[model samples]
Target: MISRSSQTAAIAFAVLILLLSASIGNAYEDVGVSISIKGTRSYKLKKEAQLLAKKQAIISYLKRVNPSAVGKSCAKQLVNDRAALIKRITTQEISQVGDYMEGSYLVRIDDEKLNYMLEELGCGAQNGATDVTILIMEEPPTKANISMILNPEDSTGVRKLRGLGPFAVFYTSYQRSIRDTIISKANKEGLKLTRLDTFDEFQKMRMSNDDPLVGVYFDDESEDFVINKRLLKVVRTRFAAQNTIVLYYRIESLYFDQVTRELNAAIAISLYDLNSGETKSVGSQDFMVIVPKGQSSVAIRDGLAEVASNAASLLMNQAKKQIRRMASIAQVHAQKKGTLPVTVTVHLKSKRTMYNVKKNLKPSMIRHSEIKGDSLILKLTKGIQADDFVYGELLGVLEGMGIKIPENNINLNGQEVIIQQ
Candidate 1:
């Protein structure tokens, strides 16, 4: 009985020893030790690490590898075991590493990178982790104001501009706040802007001349556009001739006064410059004023104003003629230089019509005159030729009233005549 008891106790002791050994082995295998990286959590790893330091650290660790202890190779084992915990982040997100503890330093991954690594490790998950914050720049609104003013030579005439002048001219002023901004933006975008104001300035400069020139000008004040000087030069150029049409008139059946030795009646004279085609009053008094049909002093003023007015018309005609002469010379000179001058002519035959016989005929009945060099050649009022002379008297009366025939150009073939110029 004592031997059996001793055997049973020895067996129980062996079993207990085996069980304790198994428990100790399992405990050693189940140990949960953590490994960590000591560098930046928020900082970019590659940029922060110097190649030299990185290489040295890796070389040192390689040197410290204990060959006797491994199952997997050190490099392979580290990669496979800890790749889930190795966080990757962009350079901008990183700040710095945290406190060191025991023999390992805490790996301070960027909050963003930390979440990323946790997700990859199958430990924690997050949707967005790499977004960045930034500020936006904007531009201010533009502001501009424009104003106008008008200045007139004579207030009364200015008020009557709508009735007389072709048009009125006005000036303008501009105020812009965002001009610089617009310029800068234009430069950045590679664009060009025309300086409209420079043209306005140029027009103002041109208008400063005393002589009249044809051009467009601006003045903000009046807010009206105008033609500064009469455009007679162009008209004369188109007409090609300046005509000096002379009119001579004599007062008939006048009774003469003996006392004071003056005539009771007077004559007036005026001329129109055909080139300009305007009727300017020329007053020439060749008569006398008398008291109750007798000579008086009142006629002197009338004579003076009349004579001056007639002389003024003649002077204008003479000026136009001179201008035409110069233009003709220029044309000849240009032709010599191989530039051809254009000439236009027109001829029309007059036909008898019942309307022409009317006693009262308007000026519109006359056809437009031909431009001959610098003169306007108006057809003279004369007789007309009818297709059939059945109503010969009516035709003659009409011719006497409204027909304009060129006298110098008339040709005769036995009373059946042809007009020629």
Candidate 2:
């Protein structure tokens, strides 16, 4: 039995303990932090520095809160616990305010979120697993955009009909050889070539036609083929080349000299940077072949082959040079733009189909990916943008690899692309 005063004192003591316990539990509930990343001249490198600063901020905060729990080996240990760390360190918002000085970037980090992450990693609490956050640091590969232009008149005209086409056998043979050689050379160099057949196709489809070099015309017709440079400029503006290379080639002239009994061919070649609209003639070659007075099928075939071989050799050499130039351009562009983010969503029709999709995805292209039930979300390397062309290209690639992508099931909204089986 206690007195009234004693009972009141006992109740007060219990209340005091409850308050202390609550305060202890909520000690690190909300914290605030500001981190400044070192200056970098390159915008691409700036992102990398910022990511490092964020990681250091977390380590520093943990050390300040509980040195004993985090220990001296914390940084090394956190590396192994990245996945767990990312799950716990969540923020309502993260803002990049501005540059601190020179090229340094200033960022605001959520203190509360940082503290919570530390707690989860056994910084000041027990019964928790250690956590670590991972930041993607590597830049993605850049894609080269190449456009091939051919002179419309190159394939025109009537001459010694050796082949099935209306054109002279030599003319037809030379055209086929040049086209095939350029395409083959481009393919060997791992270039993605875009071939536009006609100026009308270029206009109607809204294809890129910036530099005048992109309009190559073989002067085969007796009438001169006039070009509208202004229309080309308009087309370029609407379809900005950005990081693209345009290639142009034309058969300047071709004729048969009956007195000399020789077939003469003149070709001109040029390369253009669509991004800058600058043009340079890589090289030009003039070929001549002696033909017999009486033309036999064998004689015609042999003459045509000789002309084609010489022309192809010259064309191929220029193509190789252009390929090297494109590689250099791609390297510089990648440094400037970093990597383009692409989100791909794959809708599954069946469990087997889901497995197939996962398996078929290129490992090199995938930066990060996750599957939510029947749908797979992938962050793939950027080469193809979210456009009708890309969608069609993707369909073709997948189909080629034995994946059936229904035509009506594909959708692309900006970078959020979806493909249903």
Candidate 3:
């Protein structure tokens, strides 16, 4: 019988090997495919078998790494490509039997160029992971947590924040856990995924001078925190809908059965459609699960991971129709937003102008933006006719942002608009 220590070591070794194998598969690594062909022993037959074997090897690699994108075009071009994918092709000892050729060939390849080509075709692991962002905000389960929400009597934000410590550290660690767990779950579900870090940028915009969200912080278990959360959800969902991204969000409130004192995690999901900027159903299923202790951040995270996993399941399965709709909208939005970019130059003299300029523009139109010295440079999205970019469109948005471009200072150079302060 195997000893417990020995079994533990063996299991650890097995896990290490599996991890190593997965890591290697992500990079340029040798992929081997075996082929068996029977025919008259001829050079043409040898060439044919080798080519098929190389294509098969590439297909095998794609199937292993990016199964979802392994379409007909993935290996279609390789059929006519002469050779060079072969690291080596070995033949069995029994190369020929009587008048017919019957043997096996093993093809091995580690072609970096082929890897680049596959990436271009979106048939490799490098381009496979879908970009995703998720937010999980937690609150303590107590009368205060319940009473502050929608309580018209408590007008000031002061009541909820009384004597409570800064939630930064807890929020950071918990967000990290939520991100890692959900992204891992997404990858296992064949939704290879990565997180798009945008919430901080959005928050920065919200706190800019003249912004309504100035001085508003989150996770305070307050009445307005729910409203503040909508901004977060909006940014995440809008970005998700605009880009090929997955955004999972949850507002977790720790609650108790008033009678039994049973701790539970209450999770709420957003049904807001970021693509069309509307509510899809004003509904996503809310979840409540009895979990371990939740008073401390550590305990809440450990318990929350399980409930978050269930929420992830709901997002990818039951709520997937929403995701699919967003994707379809994204495709149409992509086509509409095309590659024709018009430059909109803003004087970056004020921090307010810098943040709000990007914030106010139609997300679909803001392509590339940067601050060059004192100027906030924006290369707006291309696709729309340059003539269609009327000052009416530009001025209205600028007015919304409290930016006034004087006639003398505003110059239109074809598709480019230069506004100098």
**Considering every candidate listed, which one attains the maximal lDDT?**
3
Order the candidate numbers by lDDT, best to worst. 3, 2, 1
Cα RMSD to the true fold for all candidates: 49.2, 31.6, 13.4
Sum up the clashes in candidate 3.
1
TM-score (C-alpha, index-matched) for candidate 1: 0.17
Which lDDT tens digits does candidate 2 get at residues 1-421?
6567655654553454344323321112222334444443456545555455446545554444333334434444553444444333323333354543122323343433443444444442211121111110001101011001112333344322222231232333444455555555444433334544333424543212232123322233422232435445443432331244555555554444545665555555666665466666766665665554444334444444444435544554555445434434443444344446666766655666556656765676667776655566677666745563345455655676577876666655444566766
TM per candidate: 0.17, 0.35, 0.38
* Tens-place lDDT digits, model 1, residues 1-421: 4466555654553454344323321100011122233554423443333222322232222222211112224333433433342332212222334642112122322222222332343222111111111101111101011111112332245443322121122111001111222223222222222232233322443444321222223333553343333233332332232222212111111222334433222223232333334343333323223222221223322322332223222232222223223223332333352322221122222222322232223333323334343322333222332222212332354356555545543322221222222
Kindly list the per-residue Cα lDDT of model 3 for residues 29-81, writing each as its tens digit.
Answer: 45555555668778887776666666777677555544444565656654334
Shift in Å, residue 171, candidate 1: 60
Model 3, residue 267: displacement in angstroms? 2.6
Better of 1 and 2 by lDDT: 2
Best by TM-score: 3
The TM-score that candidate 3 achieves is: 0.38
TM-score, predicted candidate 2 vs. hidden true structure: 0.35
User: How does residue 144 of candidate 1 score in lDDT?
Assistant: 13
Q: What is the C-alpha local distance difference test score of each model? A: 0.27, 0.44, 0.46
- lDDT against true structure, model 1: 0.27
